[model samples]
Target: MNKIISALCFSIVALSVVAQNNPSINQADTARQQRETDQVLREVGPGDSVPSLFSEEDADIGPQTVLRKKKPTWFRGTADAQIFYTDNMFFQDGNEQEAGLAVTTVEAALTTPPCITRFASYRAEVGYRHQFFNYFGSDDVLAVPGTILTRRFDAEDFDFDSSTAFAEIVAQTKHYQFRAGFDYTRLLGFEPLR
Candidate 1:
């Protein structure tokens, strides 16, 4: 019985070794693997240079170069005029001197562009004003010789007129401002008072 078992085991080992060493079976497997690789290459096609799948097309994208214009830096000027009047100009001490007053004023201003300097700007202005007063009441009361008795004078002595002109310059910075100006004034109709 031991000899029969040993013979059967030796036969099985020899069959397995013969099957592993067969050249025909190995050739058939190599042929099948080569065919499969050829079929996969055919399906994938040639590999020419191609655009990226995630990138935008040239026709669908907007223009890459654009032109823009700069803005103007200058500003316009300003002008103003005003007039005022009063029927009874003098009411002090309940005098009711029956005087008429009229005043007229005019002004103009201009501003310069920042093209002058980096931190400062400038502006200029000029102004003119006129005043006229008509007096119907007496200017003086002549008193009797140290007695307090008096006589009234004519209204022409009390009438008055005046005119004034002024010019100004302004300089401005980020945190501070400065201004300088001059005025010229003329008076008429009251030489004794002046």
Candidate 2:
């Protein structure tokens, strides 16, 4: 149960990280595409450069979504890593007589894109962990029927994945551009607040 929860939390963190990592890449792609396509027109009419400031819909505030140009695309990359140490090898949870085992971790990551319009990316990472636990620790705090007591624990460690997949889409007009996409996340898990 803890592992499952941990995984879910890790995924949430990773998602947020990816979202923040890329801001105008999509917009840049859209803007570049627009500049390329709009260049064909020699004359720039007032209407061309400036579309309707407000929605043209007869209804008031009707879907006030406006379009705008995007910036030029530039190459993007990242490098991340971590290191860890622990006394528990299994990292199980149960009873804790002492302060529990201690652990440290170190990890890293690196990713790159294939093209601007084409949403493609890959990442890699690796880390180490070590810990020490005792019998009172929950990792071995099992309740045996006959013995009516728990067992002592030993070593433990942490687990982390070092890979990711990402995608993005960009749309634009004269004044605004919108972007949406998904990407792989790592140990940085997610948990929505109530």
Best by TM-score: 1
**Clashing residue pairs in candidate 1 (N, C-alpha, C atoms within 3 angstroms):** none
Error at 153, model 2, angstroms: 6.4
Question: Least accurate stretch of 10 residues (summed lDDT) in model 1?
Answer: 45-54
Q: State the lDDT of candidate 1 residue by residue for 4-105, as single tens digits.
A: 999999999999999998999999888876656544533443342223223364356632322332444343433434333444444344443443333333
* Candidate 2 Cα errors over 4 Å, as ranges: 1-74, 81-156, 170-178, 184-194
Count of steric clashes across candidates, in order:
0, 42
> Model 2: how large is the Cα RMSD against the reference?
22.4
lDDT of 1 at 87: 41
Tens-place lDDT per residue, model 2, 1-194, is: 99999999999999999987786877887788676644433234333443233456435544432244343334444343333433433444542223243323232323232223323222222322222212223343233323646454322222222233545554543465665656664443222245
Q: Provide the overall lDDT of each model, using Cα atoms, as 2-decimal numbers.
A: 0.55, 0.42
Q: Which regions in candidate 1 have their CA more than 4 angstroms from the true location?
A: 1-88, 97-100, 106-116, 125-160, 173-177, 190-194
| Reference-based TM-score, model 2 | 0.22
